[model samples]
Target: MTEQRLAGKVAIVTGASRGIGRAIAERFGAEGARVVVNYIQGGEGAAAAGTAIEAAGGEALAVQADVSQSAEVRRLVRAALDRFGRVDILVNNAGVMVAKGVLETTEGDWDRTIDVNLKGAYLCSKEVAPVMIRQGAGRIINVSSNSGLYHPSAMRFTEYVVSKAGLNGLTKAMALAFGPQITVNAICPGWIRTDMVEEIDPETQQRILDETALRRWGTPGDIAAAALFLASADADFITGELLIVAGGRGMH
Candidate 1:
């Protein structure tokens, strides 16, 4: 077995049942972090993720919780503490995407989007921050999106974009609020080839690729690697910063 970088550390990864969150949970487990895989609706996927982590020679526990709910978020955190004793890392990766023009977006759509994406992050961070501050060292990584950084007029996901934008602001705020001990940061991923992206049409997918500097789509592993780096000791001094992983698509 390879040397584990995160040996003896415990991590809580939200929405770890699938996609980018699943990838991050697996990666963290492989690095020797005892992982808490939090999922909302996919019990089977969450169990599978935990099993994979254990198969990789690391520990994992699958928990069900809606991150947007304060009580549920607290329960998730308590469960992690019960299983792992401490949470050295927290990855707020749970989010939702709804594509619609701002003029056509309904209040219900906006509320749901904000609840899952923005409010979820806020609730999870609130529950974990105190624990981290007491521990005197921790990492909080928020999985944001390039859509929040630079909005493309052609793509219509008004609610989703706004939610992510709010997340970016929250990341900075938490970083400042819990500084000198914990480092908080956000990763903005672009066009990752996940189940979410598969929902788009082929022509639209190709257009996204054409815009990227790499002329290709990113994978969940790409974003996972960024999360690992931010959680690691190498990023001890970095905080309140938004790391863009868009393959230069939004840039040019």
Candidate 2:
């Protein structure tokens, strides 16, 4: 029998009801990890994620918590510890985006975007860090975006770009603070075929495809695989890095 890479591990994935977060939760479970599928909404989808994990012979628990709130994030960590004894991985996948030009965006939209995309990661990481430090090991994988970096697409998304850019900074700061025991990293994915990205206009989508070296949209599974690698022992020495899983987008 082939041994699972994450056997006996515990992972907490926020905003895991759908999209990349859901994919990560399912993939982690299949690798033999006990998963905590966290969702701020989409309760049914979260439940389904847990169910699928269990169906795959892995342990799972679906918990509803908002990562942007400290109390809720603390609750999430507590629940995971209560159920599984220790946390092995934390994928801060909870994020939001408001597609508007800089001048067209509102303050409320900006706040919401930053709260979810950047603050959410901060709160979850803060809560989990103590547990991980006590255990002497852990992984924090931030689901960031290349739009947060030096990409042409960044021009149109002010709030989202700002939030994710902050997230990337947080990734590095957290990595510096949490090491050499805990590894914190970010995965910057390009246009993935999530419901969110599918909403893009056809013209823009085609333009993205043209710029992408792969000439196609990425899958949630692609991000999940990167998460798996970061969460595994193979990445023990790696931290404070931004991995561009964007099918080579922004390369040109």
Candidate 3:
């Protein structure tokens, strides 16, 4: 039998009920990590993910928490600690997007996007870092986006782009502050084929494929693989870096 890479590790994956977060949680569980599957509203999806993890030879705890709220974030981490004893990995994958241009975006839209995408990461890290620091080692992986970078595509969702840009900055700052014991990093995924992306028109999707060097849409599993690497010992020496798993999108 092949050896498991993350045996005995405990991972908390926020927004893990579906999409990229679910893929990452399942991947980590298959590698033998006890997973805390967090969801905002999809309890059924979270339960299914937990069941899938257990069937794959790892334990799982499905917890619902809105990462944007400090109280809920606290409850999420506390639940993980109470269930698993220690948290070795934190995947701050909970995020939201506001599909509006700058002029069309309201104050509420901006706040919701920034609070969940940027501040939620900050809050989760804040709550978990002490536990990790006390344990002597940990990994914090933020699921950012390539749209955070300077690109024409970012203009479509102005608030979301700003939130992701803030997240990238937070990734670097947290890495510097939590060094020597905990490693912090971010994954900047380009055009992954999630339900959200699948909703786009086929013509637009083909245009994206044409621009991508691989000429294909990246999958949630692709991002999951990157998260696994960042959470494993193989990434111990790597920190404060953005791993772009976008199938060479925007390389032209």
Candidate 4:
């Protein structure tokens, strides 16, 4: 068998019940990292992910916590430390997207989007920062979206776009804040074939494919591979950067 790049490390992945988060958790586990999969509501999904991790000859635990809540974020971090002894990698992958135009977007919608997508990233990172700082080395990866850059007026989702854009800024700020010890970066995915994207209309899907150089939708595995690289020592010098995994669609 090949050597694991993340052997002996522990990683905490938020919103890992399904989709990209789930893929990241499994990938980290495969790389020999003891994984803590954090899910808000989907207990069964999280459990299944943990099971799969164990099946792959890795250690995993499923924990429940809403990232938007400060207390919950603290609890999640503590749970990881309690189970794994330390947190060497943190993947802030919990988020919600609401598709609506600016005028149609309500105050509650805006707040909810920001709470889960942007604020949740902040809370999780804050709770884990001290732990990483004490260790003198760590990795924090934020899952962002390409919408943060293009701002396509044709597509709605104003609140979602705003939250992702803010997350990009947060990624850079945190990277600079904890530099030379802990590396913070963001992965901006363009069109991944997650359940969320499957809900898009056929016309929209075709349009998206047409815009991409690859002419195909991306998979969760693609994003997982990028996350793995960012979490590994291979990317030790990388910080405060946004790696776009958009199948060349978002290229100007």
Candidate 5:
């Protein structure tokens, strides 16, 4: 039998009830990592993910928490430690996008996007870093967006782009702070077939596909594979890097 790369490891995947987050949780579980599936409100999906993991002969825990809140973030980290003993991987995958332009975006919309997408990553990283440092080794993967980079027509998602950009910066800062103990990195995924992008109009979607070298939207599995690679021993020397998983058109 082939050995599992993440055997005996524990992973915390925030916003893991659906889409990219769910994919990451399932993949981690299949690789023999004890997974904590976190969701803010999607309890049913979160529970289902845990059930699926167990059915596949893996251990999983479903955790409900608002990653944007420090208290809730702490509780999530505590839950993981209490259940699995220690956290070896932390995937900050919870994120939201506003469909409004800069002038059209309300104050609440802007704040909520920044709070959940940017601050949430910060809170989760902060909550788990000390524990990881004590363990002497850990991996932190932030699921950022291609919009955070030079996109030709990404002005509509001002708040989301700004949040992702900030997340990239945080990834670098945390990597520097953690040093040889923990590795912090970000994944900048372009137009993926996720719930978040289901709202895109047909014309825009087709335009994206036409521009993409692969002529298709990236899948959650693609992002999950990247996470698995970064979490593995092979990535021990990699840190504070932005790994783009776009299908050629990194930004459109």
Candidate 6:
């Protein structure tokens, strides 16, 4: 059997009901981490995530919380502590995308995007930082996006891009604040083949593939693998870095 890299660790993965977040939670579970699967909606999906984790030979607990709200974030962390006694890793994967151009974005669209994408990460991290600091070790992985960086598609989702950009900044700041004990990082994915992305028109999809250096859509597992690396001891010396899991998008 392959080594269980995260044996005995407890990890909390926010927005883990589906897509990239679910993939990361399951991957961590397979690697031997007790997972706290968090989701704001879709109870069935979150329950499935927990079941998958247990089936993969790790324990799992499902929690529902809106990470954008400080009280709920606190409740989420408290549940983890009450159940697992300690939290060794936090994957801030909860985020919302607003598909509007800068000029077309409404105030509500901007607020919701920032609240969920940027502020959600902040609230979760804030709740976990102290717990990690007291333990003298922990890992925080933020699920950001290439749009947050220099991707051409960034301009298409104005609020989403801005929120993610803010998240990138928070990742760096948290890395510094968390210090030598806790390693903070971000994974910036591009065009992952989620259900949403798969719904894009074929012509546009092909254009995206053609522009990617790998000529393929990145899978959720691709991002999950990166998250696993960041959460495990393999990244003990790594911090404040944004690992891009795109199919080499924007490289052209």
Separate clash counts for every candidate: 0, 0, 0, 0, 0, 0
Cα lDDT tens digits for candidate 2, 1-252: 677889999999999999999999999999999999999879999999999999999999999998888898889999999999999899999888777899999999999999999999999999999999999999999999999887886568898998988999999999999998899999999989987776677888888999899898999999999999999888888999999999889963
**Alpha carbon lDDT at 75, candidate 3:** 99
Instruction: For candidate 4, write residues 171-239 as lDDT tens digits.
Output: 999999988789999999988987766667888888888989998888999999999999998999999
lDDT of 1 by residue, 25-129 (tens): 999999999999999999999999999999989999999999989999999999999987889999999988866678998999999989999999989988988
Candidate 6, poorest ten consecutive residues by summed lDDT: 195-204
TM-score of each: 0.97, 0.98, 0.97, 0.98, 0.98, 0.97
lDDT of 6 by residue, 107-204 (tens): 99998889999999999999999999999999999999987896785568888888888889999999998898899999999988875465566877
| Full-model lDDT, candidate 1 | 0.91
Stretches of candidate 4 exceeding 4 Å from the true structure: 151-155
lDDT values for all models: 0.91, 0.92, 0.92, 0.92, 0.93, 0.90
TM-score of predicted model 4? 0.98
After superposition on all CA atoms, what RMSD does each candidate show versus the true structure?
A: 1.2, 1.0, 1.2, 1.1, 1.1, 1.3
The positional error of residue 207 in candidate 4, measured at the CA in angstroms, is 0.5
- Candidate 3 C-alpha lDDT tens digits along 113-145: 999999999999999999999999999999999
Q: Tell me how far the alpha carbon of residue 51 in candidate 2 is from the true structure, in angstroms, after superposition.
A: 0.8
